[model samples]
Target: MPAGKGEKQPYFHCKKLNSMMKNPKPYFLLCAALIVVSFPTWSLSKTATHLDLVKLKNGTVLEGHIVSQTARSLNLENVGGMISILRESIDRVITAEPGESAMFLGAQLLERKKFARAEFFLKIAAEYPAWRTESNASLQKLNTIKEQLEEQRREKEKSDIEKLIRRKGVEAGISELERRHSAEDDYWGSVRGRLHLLMARERLDHYDLKMAEQHLTLAEKYGVTKEQWESVRNEIVAMRRKSLLYGEDKLASRAFQSRKRPDKTAAGGGLLALAGEAKKKGEKVPPLEWLELVDRYAGENDVDPLLIWALIDTESSWRSQVVSPKGAQGLMQLMPLTAKDLEVDNPFDPEENIRGGIRYLRFLLKMFKDTDTALAAYYVGPGRVERYNGIPPAGREYVQKVRTREAALNKRFGLSPQGRTLSKS
Candidate 1:
């Protein structure tokens, strides 16, 4: 401490050396503390910026920043540069920021063509200002996809309705189409025009020239082609001339003669005259009392009214009161137990009997899904039909009789076979 300025320090520095040697434990402790504190910091610095984790289907995990995405792929940035991955191959993704996660997930789903799900995520992402622009663009794409899907669905429904028309006949098919028209807004004009055209054809087939012309006019108004209109018009004219020459005068004479007496003939004769008179007055014929009830109920149930009429004519000749040896009665020849099952109090009552019989026929038709099989079931009993896997041999004559009468009635009344026959063959 008292050494002169010119004197050099001690060469050995023995006191300092002796103090260091005695405090070697302190130096070791300080070094240990520094290492422990710095290890966690280094680890945190390496992992803290790795905010996202992507797990691939191939069992590889990637820690990176999601950069961008397209409909089919995703781009990620990491220490090893940028990498692309297919959205379909990614097993899962994890992110700390919810908004950013939604934005990225939305892009991935969009690439996968999951438009609805993508739209949901993009809407959430749109709430974040940083992702708003890209999110909105994705939403626009989703809107376009939605429109395409809706258009496809509408086209499929239209095709299905058209097929129904082919299978169910014009009136029933047009009714179904109209119901759909009321419920939908797209392609309504086209549907209406198609319905009108079908109705025109049905009317023409039935020789209702005036009604056919009215429907054709409506079809034209609704955008039917001129060629179609002209063709249908020509057909109607030809049919009308043929009907007037060969059918109408004879039908009128028969109807007038039949109506001259009610007691000698079935009530149907008078009812036919009333229908003719209503047609002359341009009025719809009211529902007839007995025989015509078959038509009304069969039409409502989508069964062929002609078939019902043929059955009634064969069973009771339109008499309302006829009993078989087996205890079958009424116009439909319903057994008492069957009438009670159908909740009919009077089997002799025409309306009740027709209703019960048609309801049973509807059930059979549904069960068989074929008119021939259903008629067979009605004739021979469903159990026998099922046992034989077809019409029983004993029931074949009955079926032939019904079919023959049905054909005769169709020819006599000028009714079309469009929706009435299950099989053309």
Candidate 2:
């Protein structure tokens, strides 16, 4: 017995171990062995529409247009042929549900890179996770690009930002500057204005009146938005007048208090009573914060708080990020162009949107020289108003709705005792 060969413990492994007795290939085989542990693996998926596919662990998706199927392979047609998968690669096979045949068919078209055909698919995709996320993410990326461009300009080309400020703000002979800028051109003038105003504010904040004055002059050279220019001019005038007369602007602030507020007259009445009940249960718009922003913005812009309330009600039902069917978006339901005109970076901010809308309301009133006509212009459009020379039917409807809502809001706020009347302005 040459030292019982099976009695010894196994030797350590090498790529190719060789013992004195002979080759120890069995030892190396043990070293080559790898224990693979896979975590619970499953794929999230969408059912196949003719060409729609789901990738499996093997990196191949079970694919084919189901003309007819057999026990082994599908009667698939790619570039003119039938194909087969060994079923091992398929986690499972799924087809679109019965009622969703057309929708799935559309998705199939999209997956095939049929851009035109994809449109129909996308419509269905709106409700589908795959399409919704893809579209929204794509859009969000584009918006981010725009914001980044602005940020870059803000840093590298301060002068551009300067132009934006001058075209929109005033710190000195700003009114005159604005008039000249307006007279110069009309395109992107508002942008130049905000830059000017921005520059002036920065300078003024740093106690650089000379720099501030220069910005105001540039702003006038470019054109500030009428509102911004007016505000700045008023400030400058007030400052100058105050220095000479030693008078204060006299600013005061106050808050509202919550109470058992309910409208007692109608089914919706008894806000005071409701407030009392709410106080007992702790649910109410605190009187201290009670539409204070609405009041302030309205007062400052010489707009009706009730009107803002009405706008909010119609636009979002108080929802901040609501986007409308007509593509009007955010709390105030501002159209893209309108929001841009207002220089609103974010419309979901209630205060920002409200101020912008009310400010525009003021601007429109000035343009039409009549409040009712201006409001009509707002609901329909300036173009339509100019074309029609009066309120359009749509505008009239909107105006009535807004007016009714405003009246209700006025009653709620205790601002108007007799509700509203559509008296001609």
Candidate 3:
């Protein structure tokens, strides 16, 4: 298509004067360059360039002009070149009238606080000399906003962690801390370092020398200065000497007992209670063959294992071969479609089902950013949750049941919502 009205004409046009090249191309190029130099900023504001978008099913999106189309394929032309795309591969297409500047569109989207889309447009604008400075400035501002949002999210997580610690005790805090601070990701290392130091001090105060030393070592690795924790380390050494001299005292043994007692058959209060009550009624509780798989994938995906446990219990009652009335299968009860999407060939296999189900849970958690809503999505479907902007009415009971089970598991394991008994002291 020719340039829009009031826009500069292309320096080269085909199908004219026996070839449209009767005039020298270099002369036309010079003329085009002069026109570009003389182009006014005010004229750019008047002409807001529009582009077409072809979004593919595999998440590749092409931004360009659809130059031509046939029944099975369409051709797109962009700065890159003309390319053909099969209709079968296309997910959706969006077309806009050709006329706006990328900078203008970026600024408009930025005003709407649509950061991701705005960043795309701003990046395009930044490539041109005329718009580079302004576009780069906008990009910087967008980055600042993203950083601020991240900081706010971290703050909210900290607040939630504090509340969980208050309600469930230090073990809960440790579990949450481990869930959020992985050694591979050091963004939260310093914060974790300080917390570990604090926990180590508490352990020392309680005369739990082993856990205290463990926390101290973790704190050092996480960025705590040796000097900052030297005194704590010294105390740990002194306590160790005392223990060696006197042998494992009753108080020390009691501290160990305090941590170990929660793992006892009778004291395993959470999900075990469910199994116990079922046994009391002569109802058979399914074997928990997938528990180890759940732990593995949950850690890999940074999901709360207790949540996965609750979901599995609610989905299939720990029966590896169970099939739901709706045709969902296995311990995690994966539907055939979901199983396929997760690349699980055998959904009834305990390991496959648990891995796929936990991964799905992780995806939902990231998409919805709330456990309850994500659980609702997990039960009903993400589309329904998104349509309702939260947990749908049909999924309320399912979410509630899973949450209740999660809390019970928390009690049973004596850990936080994210299950793990690191540092007993």
> Which should have the higher lDDT, number 1 or number 2?
1
| TM match of model 1 to true structure | 0.33
lDDT of 3 by residue, 143-163 (tens): 999899999998998898899
- Candidate 1 residues lying further than 4 Å off, grouped into runs, are 1-287, 418-425
Local accuracy of candidate 1 as per-residue lDDT tens digits, 1-425: 65689886654558776565667688778889999988765543211122468899999998655655555666654433335666778999886463565666677767787554466567877887656767787789888887998899989977887898788877877787776665223213243454456667755645566667666656675566768876886676555545444565664455456432212222234334534555577874323455456655665567776788788777777767889876788888887755764557898988999998887777677666788877777666665676677777977888888889889766655546543421211
Error of 3 at 163 (Å): 60
Every candidate's lDDT: 0.65, 0.52, 0.67
Model 1 accuracy (lDDT, Cα):
0.65
What ranges in model 2 sit over 4 Å off? 1-290, 412-414, 417-425
Better of 2 and 3 by lDDT: 3
State the lDDT at 178 in candidate 3.
85
Quote each prediction's TM-score: 0.33, 0.35, 0.35
Best by lDDT: 3
Q: In angstroms, give how far residue 368 of model 1 lies from its true place.
A: 1.1
Any idea what lDDT model 3 has? 0.67
Q: Which candidate, 1 or 3, would have the higher TM-score against the true structure?
A: 3
